[model samples]
Target chain A: MPYELYYWDGIQGRGEFVRLALEEAGADYIDVCRGPASEGQGIYAMMAVMKSKSEAHIPLAPPFLKDDDLIISHVANILMYLGPKLDLTPEDQGARHVVHGLQLTITDLVAEVHDTHHPIATSKYYEEQKEEAKARAAEFIDNRMPKFLGYFERVLRQNPKGPAHIFGDRLTYVDLSLFQVFEGLRYAFPRATAHLPTQYPHLAALHDAVAKRPNIARYLQSERRIPFNEDGIFRHYPELDKNAA
Target chain B: MPYELYYWDGIQGRGEFVRLALEEAGADYIDVCRGPASEGQGIYAMMAVMKSKSEAHIPLAPPFLKDDDLIISHVANILMYLGPKLDLTPEDQGARHVVHGLQLTITDLVAEVHDTHHPIATSKYYEEQKEEAKARAAEFIDNRMPKFLGYFERVLRQNPKGPAHIFGDRLTYVDLSLFQVFEGLRYAFPRATAHLPTQYPHLAALHDAVAKRPNIARYLQSERRIPFNEDGIFRHYPELDKNAA
Candidate 1:
């Protein structure tokens, strides 16, 4: 059976990570919320799962997947489940765990990226938190971003198989997710990541390789790929982008 | 052979999640960094694994587990690896995934808690960002904390196995982690969580139950249980606690 994905319809948000995996694997899946409510594939359908009394596993938020009777949530956890089934992870047990660990770290970096715009609270408007966001973005660009990106670069360099991929020579879901991170960072903080090609050469190369992949290339050019916007986790604010260079 | 757990020497931090599992399961393990450096079991030992070129999996941060040749990092990933081996997770595959999802949610909450004091930057001192910290704390108390706690409460209510535990009737590592979260919140934001007994009764009950467990009770009183301080993830700051009520 084709997988069913539940997420907000408007923006990519965290759902994009899961979407990247599904798109790259060319898996048969439905973007449930993007469909109409008349066909039982809209926000209501997603809310049904969220508010479902019968669901043994209630997802805290969207970007959850349903395959057969199994429903799983959390970006890293969902990717971990999909990775093996879709052949996006290493087969060995230890290697699998390593990939999972990398994914979780990526999850951490994404959360930090979200905080750049919504440092005070997600419930409030960005206008209310603009000043704090500027300060937060400064720290993120100066310290946290480099720290996280550098760690990933080191991991790629240390990968025994080759630096071409995060794990073995074959691409894993992590490599795809890293590419998304690179894409998002560039969109969100162009000046901040202007030197990424030299600073994070391996990640830049991986991003290029993943972008050139047949499936991902088609998905990127297709309407399926959502454009980055202010409403998304990675947002571009001119004032906050200052000092990023 | 006994597993080697590596984390910072002084504070509980994220490593406490892994330690709670080892303590509750009565598994043979070493708190590697807590031991003396002379015996190659201090921060140096932990750094060796992280910096080692020979190690197949280099941890992004501390709180990684070293089991013979295999090294796994990230709190939830480490617990997922240890959960099955230590028999802390539910037996069924679907149920196991549910527990993992819950653990990842808990991880999200912990990261937010860390941000309450360090909303602007982790590299900067709390004093440097005191105003931002206060604003962040207000939002955390008013919105984020309640949202996360309520979600878990709904999960407990929806659990087919009863509300005594998060999953089945038995205690999983998630329950232990929740107990720690409760403890940390109570310590860090006493005013914010003062009414937790009435608000999050299931979590309160779970915390109580876990605390009374023979092993957990001992662990709590022993030196192994590091007290919450400014150096750790959950820090008690009087200024940040304002208006929490």
Candidate 2:
């Protein structure tokens, strides 16, 4: 059975989380809206399919996954579906709930990141709100970054299993996502993240461990992975970067 | 088994969605955080029970659910966990995916609502971001509103069950959530929703049908149902309201 992954090729955005899962799982899948199609290829063709409505069920956005019989949307929800399928979620319901609670916290963090730039509006240009972004970025840098990262660091530190994996000892999708958040934060806020890992050794180790995972390492090296850029969610605006002092 | 809900007093905010699900299902529960301390107790005590450490798996935020041995957070994730338990989700994986898809869309909508006033920064006053918010709010009202509500209207139209419910003939968690979004939007963007409801009959019908459901109806009449207020996500600012004229 073939799985079709749909997302805009213009930016990594939210789609990459799902992509990371698929890559790590080594699933048989195609980045439908992405990849080569010669003349009518890449993201354009994928967009055509999404807007076409010929496909059985339409996903609300690109990050949706189409398995043989199921079309799943929502980043965390998609991970929920793929988790048990790929041994990423714990078998027990209680554990899964804890994992989900943590993922939702990550969702909150991601929203904050988006806000650091857009602040008041998603429809306008970031430049239009550049002044607003500066203030929002300051509050985010001062309050939110610490609040969110601190919560995760606490979760890691308080984990019963010696502060290793977020939920279970084995790597879960939540762990992988935390790694992504750290990577994106570092890319976007190197000055901030440099000071961050020191506060949470376990989180840093987990981020490093996930990056070293064989499949992720391969995927990162491969051309399939899209590089982070200004257009993407974690864009680095040197102005938003905190001072090292 | 007792179920406890923790959130601030007054205004449904995010907690309303959870309240709707619990009410619709006629579940045995308590809205502890909002209830009178003499009878229901404050959030601190609610926190005490939640963080008892007997389970040691307490949620990081309010609006979490504690049912017997399981606890969950995130509005949508909580619904996902509760959907099956309350028999609000479909039996098949495909249907469940669709339901989860809608829930996540609601999450996006919620975030957008928060952005309307806090377009520049959530940590600062709306007054500070008023200018940027005016621009963002205009785009949100003009573009995102129609896009989101229109897509949902299409979902209802395409539901294959006479467009009475969001999913099918029966009431699903998503249906209740859709109604909540309608109520929130109406409260937050009264003029905008009014101008647009005629354009999406299916969604309008959904808002009506869910309102009349027995349990939901009772809950609305009860004082337990908080009115929309400035403290919540969907704030009503006259400037942001679309003039019916």
Candidate 3:
């Protein structure tokens, strides 16, 4: 059976992170909610899966991968499972552990980005907390962005093999994630992102390299890859962008 | 060789989250930051290990666990490692996924609690962010606490066997974490927490059950379990607490 990815129908929120990895790996998978043939998912469907009494044994949340018997949830956890199968992680345990550490760091950065908009409540609208978002965004652009990006760039520049990949010479899921993060920050904060591009040349190169990969390139151009929108995690909130130092 | 848990010596913050599970399992481990002379630990030694670059790998922050060759960082990841060792997870893969999902949810809640005080910037002092923290804390107390707590309560209530554990009748690391969340919230938001004494009674009972486990009781009484203080994640800033819920 093909991998089953359950997530919100419209947005490329957390689920897209998992989707990108699967798509890049050329893995046979189904986007459950989007196709006409497949059943659409809403919050209630998600709740029913969680709350409904079933021997089905529900995974934590959407974006869980059911390949054969393994049910992996937690965006990072799913990636951890796929990393080896798809050859997205380094073969060495130490390198793999470091890559995992970096993935968890990305998880932190994503959470921070999500919090900038949903500072008050996850269910509440971004408009409801615009002022808080403004305050939070100021910190995000000036402080958090550089801190996370700086760390990633540092990992790239300091890579003993070369500055080409995050872990070592070869591409890993983190390289893909870094591409997403760079794409996301650039989309979400163009003004700040533009000036800071040259500072992390290695990271910029990795982002470009990942984008240029044949499978990922095709996925990006295909209708399957959702466009970045306000509904997604990487939204172009002009107010959040600021001039970089 | 014993497992070395490298973390802050002062408070039962994130590290304690890992400690509770390890304790509850009665697993043979040493708190590398704080332990008796026979047990082997000291503050200076822990900090040195955290900051030392001589090692092949270094965590960006503490709460990193070392089991033989495995040096796992991140609270959830460490618990993921311990969950299996301690039999704190289900035998089935699907069940393990649900437990991991619940674990990640706890991770989200912990982040929210941290944001209640550091809504501005992690680098800034609580005093510096006091004004913003107050506004953020209000939203958290009024909205987030209920939403997260309600979700966990639902997970418990939805369990087929009973509402006792996160996954099923058998105890998991998530149950140990639920205990910590309750303790933290009760300390940080005593007024608000009291209002829900019986709301999540099963979760409450689970918390009690985990705490009373002989190993956890020994750890608590053995001067290893640090008291909640201002330095930890769940700090009680009187101005931020709910005077009356």
Point to the candidate with the largest DockQ.
1
lDDT of 3 by residue, B163-232 (tens): 7777778888888889899999999988878867687777788878877888877887887778899999
Residue A172 shift from truth in candidate 2, angstroms: 0.4
Mind giving the per-residue lDDT tens digits that candidate 3 earns over A22-138?
Answer: 888999887766755436444454555555554343554576666775556778878877788889998875556567777888999998998878776676898988887887888
What fraction of the native interface does candidate 1 get right in terms of contacts?
0.74
When candidate 2 is compared with the true two-chain complex, its DockQ is 0.54
Instruction: Estimate the overall C-alpha local distance difference test score of candidate 3.
Output: 0.79
Error of 3 at A118 (Å): 2.8
Better of 1 and 2 by TM-score: 1
Candidate 3 DockQ score?
A: 0.40
State the DockQ of every prediction.
0.74, 0.54, 0.40
iRMS of candidate 3, Å: 3.3
Local lDDT at A235 for model 2: 81
Model 3 / residue A20 / CA error / Å: 0.8
Winner on lDDT (1 vs 2)? 1
Interface RMSD, candidates in the order listed: 1.4, 2.7, 3.3
TM-score (chain A only) for the predictions, listed in order: 0.97, 0.91, 0.92
Name the runs in model 3 displaced over 4 angstroms: A37-47, A50-61, A66-71, A90-97, B35-57, B243-245
Candidate 2's C-alpha runs over 4 A off are A38-41, A53-57, B36-40, B47-57
